[model samples]
Target: MVKKKKGRSVKKNPNVNLESEELTQAPHSFIIQRGLGHGHIVELTRDFRKLMEPFTAKSLQEHKKNTIKDFVSVAGLLHVTHLCIFSQTEVGMYFKVGRLPKGPTLTFKVQNFSLAKDVVSSLKKQLVVEKAFKRSPLIVLNSFNSDTAHMKLMASMFQNMFPKINLTNVDLNNIRRCVLLNYNPATDLIDFRHYVIKIVPVGVSKGVKKVIQGKIPDLSKCNDISEFFTRAAILSESEMEDDPNSHITVNQKLVSRGNVEQGQSAIKLTELGPRMTLQLMKVEDGLLDGIVLYHHHIHKSEEEKLEIQKKRDSKRKLKEKRKQVQEANKKRKEAEREESKQKSLKGMPKSTVDKDSVEERDDDVQYYREEVGAEPDKDLFLDNNQTKNDVSKVLRKFKKKKNENFCKNKEDKFERNKQKFGVKRTTQFKQNKSRVRNRLVGKTFNKKSNVKRKSK
Candidate 1:
């Protein structure tokens, strides 16, 4: 038999936690800001309302209201204009609060000026790439939400222009025709490109706001307005990528939902009560069309843990069953061994032969004594009482039987002789008579012969 190595097998706990501690940390940010441009903000808000209307149809309107309120609470209105107000400030001095998703939320003193400069340069690239000189305003998309195929094609086209980039998260939004790029000097950030288009309010004069709003702002120029904001907002977002500990902050408003507490940059009890907590986190790069952020829990792997536990329990049960079967077999083997011993002991001469031999000897002695006592001639019969009696009885029976047999044989012989020949008694009488007659004749003849001789 080959000897097995006595190495211990390590068993893993399936319930071991897979979620990182980074998920537990709430979103932290250097600043908090609300968007400006109240009318556009309201329009965005209306868009959110329309999105949530469908969700409310499934339940009491309160459900939808809570969701909206929660998103606003965590992401802080989720209005791009509001977020822009903070972007206007210098890069270092933090002001507004930002929500982080899967990563950590951090508070940092703005340490680098190049980070701000990079943001501006990233935005400038958008206009140049889109070729904004044309009438049909170009559309720019952030690398975050770009489709893989399109991203790859774009990457190939721009291989000589820029480094390789991944566009796995992209999907075409309401706007079309865009360039996606990753441009972050401090932290790698996704960016979208197009000529900056600004929507001028009905009342505002054509000045700095108008200049920022761009040349043409109208329904026909809606696409342009979208592209302009896409570039302007590029610099607004400040994400910390160096700190594996840091996460991007975002608002839930774009998706038209409430704030999340578990994975967001900040964790806070809702105004409603302790029943729920509001969470805020960034979902994607700022230049991406969709709002950045989500609300979810740091969920535990419950099902896997239960499955592991069940497996262990089943293995234990199987082991116990096998042990029971082995024990029963052992008992049965022992019982068989015991039974075999009993069988061997049963035929032992000590009990079957010796035990009975002793009894039989004693019985023989008693039988002899009884025979002696029963006999009348005790002295003569003592030595061979049984043998003598047997012999005498046999002789007497033989003599009596022999006499009976002789009589029967003589009768049978006489009967057979009478049948075979006539009687002999009359023969003797006839013979005597003949002899007397013959004697008489001879005497007469003799007298006659004497007389004749005298006469001569």
Candidate 2:
């Protein structure tokens, strides 16, 4: 055995080695491993796997695709690389190399990833052969911005291709080259070339529309790219007036027809884009027609009908509203008239009477005084005999309104007496009402009833 053992045997039992693997396990260190808390690694691994799943073998190697790699490269230059999962367009798994920042993180401009991928792959492969992309990220951005629907479709396709992509890996910074193309079929030339088409909410581009309208908008005050787009224009007067962002400007020289002149406005496309144009088409009850690169939506009759309908609707509504207001006013007026009639009835036969008139039968005893003998104070007349002071006191408490009736029978009798005597006294007259106070002695019936009535 000693003689045979002279040669050192490196081979060991596979089963024994496998069993010892547990004993000699690799040492785990680093903060990531130290207090990883149970299952943290599992969770991290799961997330990493999920993140990597989106960059599939197919996605990365699809040479025929308007590859996401090309989009990422162009977007990286613009510093908007955060659009990896498409869902994480704002923020996600962001990786940076050194500090000489690359480009935009996302390229939503490319219509079809597959087509773009083909072009990019071919170009990249050729570039690689030429050693062009070895030092630089290939920045290719092609924008088919005329069709939001198309762009949305493209986004869906990307989502389908990379369903498991981790949204957290998205970056949105370092935007690079941007290519914007609006192909006009009528002229067969691209319109308003702005390669750097910064993405923003549609609302932000409203100001750009105004700018295109020759309003010379305050670009310095712009808050975002959308604001710039909203205020942007086609940079030509004829194109500025055409609205709804649907019309395509054509150089008459490019597509010359006897009727069509250079720099002249043409009915080649709709004023508004697809959405508005579609709505306009429905109004005309006609199907939309597509041009080579631009969309030509013909709906003149529909437009006229819409205007007519709008006017008719406005008039109808106005008439209805006016009728309602008139009815309300009529009711209010009727109510007011009824209330006034009732108020007139309430003061019927109202009176201001002298206390002595209830007892006195002789009209000669009654007296009404005048101020300064000749000046008659119309408001101070007494109904029966009463002292000036006494009548004054009563009149003070009971005001004589224009609607009051002051015991006209007594007044008539007094007038008769004056006529019979054929006398008009120039001196101030006064009568004593206390002498007729004896009239009230027999008026009361029961003390309890009187007290209750008085309380009421």
Best by lDDT: 1
Model 2 TM-score relative to the real fold: 0.16
Model 2 lDDT tens row, 371-427: 244534544444444566786877766765422446766678788877765444412
Distance from true location, Cα of 67 in model 1, Å: 58
Model 1 stretches astray by more than 4 angstroms = 1-300, 342-346, 371-456
lDDT tens digits by residue: candidate 1, 1-456: 999877653445554554344322212111222333232322322322222221111121222224322433444222211111121233222212222222112111222222222333545332222222222222233443344432343333233222122355432121122233343323433232322331112222223233544545443433655464444433333421123233323322222122232223321111100010111212222221222222123333767657756886798899999999999999999999999999988766655665576676567667777887752434332324456788899999999999999999998887776566534634555656776787788833334333444564
TM-score of each: 0.16, 0.16
**Model 1 TM-score (2 dp):** 0.16
Report each candidate's C-alpha RMSD, comma-separated, in the order given.
38.6, 38.2
> Model 1 Cα displacement at 391 (Å)?
22
